[model samples]
Target: MYVRTVYATGDPAKIDESLDALRVEAPKLLADQPGYRGYSLFADREIGKIMMGSWWESEQAQRNSDDHLKERRAALLAPFAHTVTVDSWEAVVFTPSLQVQAGAGFRLSRFDVDPSDVDLLVQTFKNTVLPKVQAIAGFEGMALLIDPAKGRGSVGAFFTDRAALVASRGAQSAARGEATAKARVTMRSIEEFEVVLVERV
Candidate 1:
């Protein structure tokens, strides 16, 4: 599947309001679109970072979504967000898959990959990282998203809760390190978030 992630940042105090729209309104607006598959929302209330990933059956469908609800999206987010950004990626790896649970924990790791080595990097993720991540006690699922043209990619791990997310740090780090070295990709940022909602159809 192809995914489009909307990133919004603004008033930390209004974070909940922004998330509420995505959890409720945004999905409704997207449901009727062609090739729509699902939506997953994540947030870091402390920093007022809100990210919602919408899944589509193809790259074209994903691209279509960006224009499908432009007006409504702006209206819904403008009150709380000062800046909103969008990104699209092809899902290279989705293992076991991300489960939908309001309070689940999602840990996201960003990377700057070698454009020419996209396939090698994906294999490294599936082979070098997936096994270690799956071994974590609270692991639920994992996904790897890549933008070959931009040399950017990110991987996310879903956990049962905060404790599980915290406990799995060591192993996750080791696996990420190996993948980074082997794939010749630069690891960027890593942060954990609370899953607000996930709606699939």
Candidate 2:
């Protein structure tokens, strides 16, 4: 599947109202469009940020939806235009084999794997962590990717919220103590990042 993420920034105080509007109205407006799978809205009051993400079967589906809504949603969003910045993009590495719960949000976490432990790392993520995550309250989905050319790796995707991610992260770290220790001995480093823009799709 192709995924698109858009960030709309506005006054922190207004995030709740904006999110409420989208949660209640946007789906009703775009539900039947071709290739449109679904969407989720995220609100971060502390940072004055709001995110909108959607999944589509193909690039064409995204194009169609964007074009169909450009004129109409533009007017609906005008009042908040002054504080919003919109961005969209496609996914480079994605896996559809995983299952996630409903009503979840998204996140992008980056990890760098040590070459010697790569295989073990992959197995643990696919066989263990992934399952535990799927069972969480807003657990949505995730993608684990390796940047062979760059000699590094990363995971970017979604979660229901920061708390869900926190829980999963803790459980995974603890569950794989021995294996994780072995990997860490050969480890380079790891970092997590939030996806801010999805430009292509």
Q: Assess candidate 1 and give its TM-score to the true structure.
A: 0.95
Tell me the TM-score of model 2: 0.56
Please identify model 1 stretches exceeding 4 Å from their true place. none
Candidate number achieving the greatest lDDT relative to the actual structure? 1
lDDT for predicted candidate 1 compared with the true structure: 0.87
Residue range 1-201, candidate 2, lDDT tens digits: 555555566676665665666667677666767877766555555667666667677878877788787665555544443455443444444555444443434454444556666667667767765676566555556655454334345445566556666656664445335445645323344333233222112
- The global Cα lDDT (0 to 1) of model 2 is 0.56
| Every model's TM-score | 0.95, 0.56
Count clashing residue pairs per candidate: 0, 7
